[model samples]
Target chain A: MSAVVILTPAIVAGWPTIVAAVAGAASALGLVVKQSVKQDIDIAQQTQATEQTVEVELAKSEVVAQNLAKEKEIVVTKGDIELSVSRDERGRCKVCAKGKGKTKAELKQIAEQFAQKMAQCFVYNRVATELKNKGFQTVNEEVMEDQSIRINVRRWVD
Target chain B: MAQHDVEIVISKTGEVKVHIKGVKGKGCLEYAKWLSKIVGSVREQKLTSEYYEPEVKSKIDLHQQLNDE
Candidate 1:
């Protein structure tokens, strides 16, 4: 490694970019895009009866969480489990998972999975966009060394 | 042309380690900031001396000069 100086990262993006980030995150997290007649996306709010919807928030959120606003929300459901992704009051993106048949632990696990995917998607979208804006073109991007996504970028700069 | 290369390793856990090459001065910070915005919070940052060196000036500068004449 040559003498390359590294500095603090500066984030320059607006709310619309955050929305795109969410869209990209949704795709990375295996969310299926459905056709909607209207502009707003309404989740299939089911469970029919007066069911319990437990909401749990993560306390150990990172400092970078402050870069977000309450822009977009993604609702994911599999079987009885329902998960919602949105940025919390603390600016940290959160995922709420609830279900009728699952125990509290099961719900927690699902929520945790959603949280992980959100984090991964957040990181992926952030990096790719930044590299592009700085004039770096992607050479190769892939998951490696235990499911990690590695991206190689090259650019001509002065 | 001078080539600036970046290698980003984002772990499955959402942690990232970035390696920047062929970029000098404050220009590289642009890439860093752009990335941190996407990836969430930064845990740690390690800056190499190349960051302190003069910006990477491509050989194309000479070609541009010759073309002007």
Candidate 2:
């Protein structure tokens, strides 16, 4: 090996790209996308009771460029839990988790997990696309036990 | 021709660990720089012993020949 680099990914992309990552994240986490009405009903039913809601925001990041309409958000459901991924007025990505009969800590954990998954998916997609564009071919790809993604790629440089 | 290999590990928290292999000397730095630009801000970087090893002259010559062609 010649060098090792440690980097922290910044999720700064347009709304479309952010949505793509959200979709990928949802798929990876086995969450199903719910329609707008279903999402509203789920959130309403949860709010009616003593359900907890937790919001986690991406750090030092912004989803800029695309003009996202007001009240536009992507909602996914996994069992009784509902996760809403949206961009706030400041253009920062936010993940809100709400579930009935769940504690604040539980909701917070869920939200944080979803946020991390989304960020990972975003980085993977961006990096893989860029690598392929630069003429690199994937040699191997796998997910580790810790949920981290490992990708090995090679290119012939002449 | 020289084969350049890169191993990228993206943690669950979105932190990236990149290991560049089969590239010696300054060429490896170029790959590191390129990856940093694509990924995000670099938190840390380290150069290994292979980075200090002399580059293969034939590889450079082959690259030059390819460019000339």
Candidate 3:
């Protein structure tokens, strides 16, 4: 090996790119996307009834695309849990999780987990695409027991 | 040409670990920089013994010549 590097991903992208990553994350976590209108109505009606709501900001992330319209968000559902992912006023990526019978800690954990999954999906897509553009062919790709993704690629360079 | 291999591991939390192989000298640094741009900030990095080896240009030329023969 010539070198080894450890990097922490910073997700900064436009709305479309963010949505792509969100879709990847949702699919990986077995979450279903809820219709926007129905999600809004449900959220409005359930806000008062749900005692636990937690919001988690993704670390080192910025949604650089400006002027995003209000209520433009991705809503996903898994069982009784609802997650809303959006870019806040300060351009930070935020994940809000709410469940009817869950505690604040439980909601917080769910939000944090979702945020991690989203970041992972974003990084994986970006790196794999870039490597392909650089003329590297993937030799092996697998998910480890601990859920980490490992990709090996090779290229003949002069 | 020299075959350059890169092994990338993206952790569950989105942290990336990259191991660049078959690239000697400063050439490996170029790959590291390019990957870092695509991924994010480098939390830590280490250069191995291969990084101190001679450049791969001579090896590439030798292989080309052998193929031509």
Task: List A-chain TM-scores for all predictions.
Answer: 0.63, 0.89, 0.91
Per-model CA lDDT versus the true structure = 0.60, 0.87, 0.88
User: Candidate 1's residue-wise lDDT over A1-158, tens digit each?
Assistant: 43222223222234444345445545666654333211243434432344445565543443243444444555655566666655566655456666787777877876776555555555677667667776879999988858678888998854
Please report the interface RMSD of model 1 to 1 decimal: 4.0
Please write out the lDDT profile of model 3 over residues A1-158, one tens digit for every residue.
Answer: 79999998999888778888888889999999875443574557565663578999999988875676244688888998988888788888899898889999999999999999999999999999899999999999999999999999999977
- The per-model DockQ list reads 0.27, 0.71, 0.78
Task: List model 2 lDDT by residue over A48-125, tens digit each.
Answer: 677677899988668886375235578889999989888788888899898888989999999999999999999999
Q: Deviation in angstroms for A81 in model 1?
A: 1.7
Best by lDDT: 3
**Tens digits of per-residue lDDT for model 1 on B1-69?**
678788887665566777877777766676666556555445566667877777745555444345554
Candidate 1 chain B lowest-lDDT run of ten: B60-69
Clashing pairs in 2: none
Superposed model 3: Cα runs more than 4 Å off: A36-48, A69-71, B56-69
- For candidate 2, give the lDDT of residue B21: 96
Return the candidate ranking by lDDT, descending.
Answer: 3, 2, 1
Maximum-DockQ candidate: 3
Model 1: residue A18 alpha-carbon error in angstroms: 5.4
